[model samples]
Target: MTDVSVERRGHIAVVTVHRPPANYFDFALIHDLADAFEGLDAGDCRAAVLAAEGKHFCAGADFGGGGAPGERVDSSRLLYREAVRLFRVGVPVVAAVHGAAVGGGLGLACAADFRVTVAGARFHANFAALGFHQGFGLSATLPRLVGAQRAAELLYTARKLTGEQAVALGLADRLADGADPLPAAMAFADEIAASAPLTVRSMKQTLRAGLADEVAAATERELSEQARLWATEDCAIGIAANLAREVPVFVGR
Candidate 1:
């Protein structure tokens, strides 16, 4: 089965990520998503709904495969390059986040213009817990969504928030009425499609002017910090503890 698929519904494009269970992403997955968004931007699509077919929207990157920290950082640089391309998509996007959007996964959701989630859905910025700076352009996007103070708190604590709490904090835009978020997200996209397409696109461009450049710059800083931290013993401990489902004990080194 294809890992990524796009279905056209009227003027709304429904883009789906097909990696299962946790839907942990790598460079390939992120590249495919960017390609899909760019395709929609060049086509007749007015808006898009981004949804994943899995128990969780995305659990973040899979770090179980052993690699030296420097090697990992090198691989992540390419992935983050594609991630920034997502912010350059011209049309509006609504994410259907029915389950966990953790770490970089939260960054993916933030790439969308809005999010539709269920009450039990989870949103987490877990980079701090992983002993690295947040990547995927979250340094710019998270603060844009929820403001600087809330973004700082979320990043520092790596606190998990439910869908309702995410909406309360402006992390998520709407709460799904049911367990499934796809219908709600599609409906939201349809609303955008119903608007005058040219006007909507122009307004979106005006509102988001310079955002892609901002995200690009922010990702550069994030990458440098992450690369430095990835080599640290504290980061190693943090990754091990996370994989083992244990709370990490960090020592400043």
Candidate 2:
């Protein structure tokens, strides 16, 4: 089954991430998401909303991607590239975030010009917890939204921020409060769609340029951190502890 589902809503294209049981990212979802965004970027839609069907928009990279275990380190870069393309697309994009937006999922939300999350949405950049590298321009985007101090706290500590906290920290543009976020996001998307597409696109592009430098720097930092962390005993310890439902006993090796 296709993990990513895309459909048109008027001039708005609604994309849903359907990978269940936490909706972990896989190569297929990444590629299919790219296809969907490519189609949307081709001028068929004036706006789009990214929504997930399950409890999460995404967990992160599939641990099984490089093979089940003890395998090569294969990763999916499609989501990253496609997201950059989509972010640079000359149209409005709204992300409707609910449940857990963890690791790359938060990065996905960052790609959108606007976002709405349920009041109870959970925001996290738990890459450090897994000893994995960051993706989806998060290195640049997170700090850009949450400031250096807050971003560091979230990333370095792998703390999960609540939806209200996310909104307060400026990671989200709107919170669903007591209502379903999808409708509010769709309404907001419609509002943006009603505006001149060129103007809307230009504004988004212009606003993001300042963050581009940050994002680029973050890309290198994330890669470096990932490389170092992946080689240490910490990664396996963390993963094993997570899988085993136990607190990691860091040896600081």
Off by over 4 Å in 1: none
Spell out the clash pairs found in candidate 1. none
lDDT of 2 at 65: 32
RMSD values, in order shown: 1.0, 2.7
How good is model 2 by TM-score?
A: 0.87
| lDDT of candidate 1 over 1-253, digit per residue (tens) | 3589999988999999999888899999999999999999998999999999889999889888879878888888899899989988899999999889999999999999999999989999999898989988999999999999999999999999999999999999999887899999999998899999889989988998988899999989999999899988889989999999999999975
Which lDDT value does model 2 have at 208? 74
Top TM-score prediction, candidate number: 1
TM-score of each: 0.98, 0.87
Task: Rate residue 50 of model 2 by lDDT.
Answer: 83
In model 2, what is the error at residue 248, expressed in angstroms?
Answer: 1.6
